[model samples]
Target: MTLLSMYFLAGVLAVSALAVDFAYLLSARNQLQVAADAAAHAALYYREQHDAEDAKVKAVAIANHSMPEDSYGAVLRAEDIEFGHWDYDSQTFTVDDFSKDAVRVRPGRTETRGNPVAAHLFAILNKPMWDMTAQAVFVVFDPHCLREGFVGDKVVDIQSNNGYEKGFCVHSNQYVSVNSNNTFEAGTVVSMPDSDEIELPRSGFESNAGLQAALRNGYYRLRILNQMDRIYEDLYWASGDFLPDYIASAVPITVSQKKLTNADLIPERVHRVNCGGQALQIEAGTLLHRVVVVTDCAIRFGAGVILDEAVIITQSTDAKSINSASDLQIGRDDACADGGGAQIITYGGLEVPAALKFFGGQVIAKGNVSFSADAGGIEGASVIAGGTISGTSNMTMGYCGTGMDDNFTVPYFRLAF
Candidate 1:
């Protein structure tokens, strides 16, 4: 062949070799990216359960699937070309030791290089291999969604189990109106804010006219229609007994006069505190130093958890202070001595197991406060015996404050994932 013809042929061959190498690199890069993406998605599924091991296995499996394979001889064949040293596990070039053709699949990150293709005419020019690399990162997916309201209807239901009547004392700055037609029985008391003209269900009251007149004149009526509607919707979601099985099965609870020395005042598993006996479970516990704070905890009563001190406060704010005359604060007190600030005083729910005898003190329920027992038989923390829970024409119950109101906010659940 002529010298000029030879040179031309060599140039054409080199160009073709470059094209093949470039195509293989591109294909390999695409595959690597796909593998990385799939691996990341799979890792997210086990992020909360398995962590790193699960993620690594899933990534390798995905990478293997992305590569092309053949049967029998199992040669790396693609585009009518036979490639050598395509070791996926090592992700390195088989032909050239220093070649850029390699894939490194690591936990969290995967790196890959294009296939190794020998140059035809370029081989004479000392060009043996073309190298290409791609990298991909894995991340967990996160999304935010808000949940609100109670799980079901009937936020509060007062029933007579042993021929005893029940009642509630609802105190609120807003108007109180019953929306249900359920009977208030013969001795139910409903209170409200103002003595204004109000309507009542005929079946709920024998003295419908008297009840309306009292409500109009700011006299908290003994019976209001559908009073359960005024309760915060979240109150219904709380888990625990509103009344204890028996009044005498309560355990005594004591608080020291000095500040609490430990972060965990009660056992971790003690989710509920029941006082169901004649004696008050929580007696004359002094708050001379920092106040007793119950956090991430529950104070349940059997039937007779009495409060020796009427000055007890259930403070809901982070500062932990009594806001009103009837307010009682529970949870950690950051201001108290030796306050580690480690105490988690946030309770998801609160239940009154039985009639709570409160001499004084505010019951501040940061979460939901449920009262499902009969009103007349037992004297609850707020309700008196046979007094009939009388509220003004506009009495309110449940969490009535602003910002994430009880009716609008739902309890947060601890998901496994």
Candidate 2:
């Protein structure tokens, strides 16, 4: 062959060799891209489950699955792929310079680039293996999402009986306002606004016997005097050292009454009580200590369960504190600071199986607060209710009142794919 012809042939052969290498690089890039995608998805899944180590292992496994495994060096070559976090602004990834010989995966710093498959296709003429790195990101699912199915009432009214205190007292971390025509008393020694406005109906003192009878007869209208009023009420009467003559001429009147019953205070454990097959009954004076964790459980009371402490009811557990004559009090405990010290945290919704009779006490519902019964079933006696009622699609209500019409401003998480 002539010298010119020989030179032309050599040029053609060089071009052909470049094309072959380019095709091989393209195939490798495509495989790497597949590996990266699989690794990223796997890592994300693991993070959602709160398992970081497992996530890494799964990611590696996915990378291996997407890599070639026919040759003796196939497994080793696939292991060269690295996975990590990519910082966009930093313009880098967890793995700065990964290669078939150096397969070290970096933590908290992964570089993100155009698809690995595209990179391989472009690496035909120069550069070793392209930058084929994988990254994963995940966010936790907020428990708040579980609160999206609550429905209930807001305003409640409790009438006063002879000398019985009317209305109720409420303490909340959120805003609370009273609109009912009743008296509100701060049960504790600490004086609160509007305490004086809430007083007994006739005598302005609690008629224990009459109140008991009313409760038993299902007539929650009987009012009791707000004894705590002495600290706040200016009209309180105190007759002491009556003139000697007037005291001597007075006749003694016979007064008989039944003793008040103390509630069963159960400490930090789960208890199953009957709600008269109505909803779930928690008799008055019932105390739950510690956190009462429940699962798909319902607590219905004949009168209502007086929660002197915090009660947490999750989706796995359903809790209902329904009373006929008194308000369902939650988060009241001696350990509680200035407030009633009781907290009712619900991951699920609250159902007032009957008319809620709010005699007294505050409610802090983190979930939805709902009333299903009519006046006959539920009545808003002298009660102060507040808390967020969340139900579906970022929807929330009454984060601070008895009604489910307010919005919640608490921080929450969102689960994603």
Q: TM-score for candidate 1, please give it.
A: 0.27
Question: Judged by lDDT against the true structure, how good is candidate 1?
Answer: 0.29
| Tens-digit lDDT track of model 2 for 1-417 | 699999999889877776776787666655555555556555554444344455557666766576634321122222343434344476454542221111233211012322233333234456544443322232222122111212122222223221222221222222222222222222211112223332234543343232222221111110111111221121111122211111122222111211112233234333222233233334465554442323223444334445443332322123343223344444332221332323233334455544342211233342345443222211122122233321111111111123211112122222121
Q: lDDT for model 2, please.
A: 0.32
Give the count of colliding residue pairs in each prediction.
Answer: 58, 66
Q: Per-residue CA lDDT of candidate 1, range 355-397, in tens?
A: 3212112233333344333232222223211112221121111
The top-ranked prediction according to lDDT is 2
* Candidate 1 error regions (>4 Å): 1-20, 44-47, 68-104, 107-265, 270-417
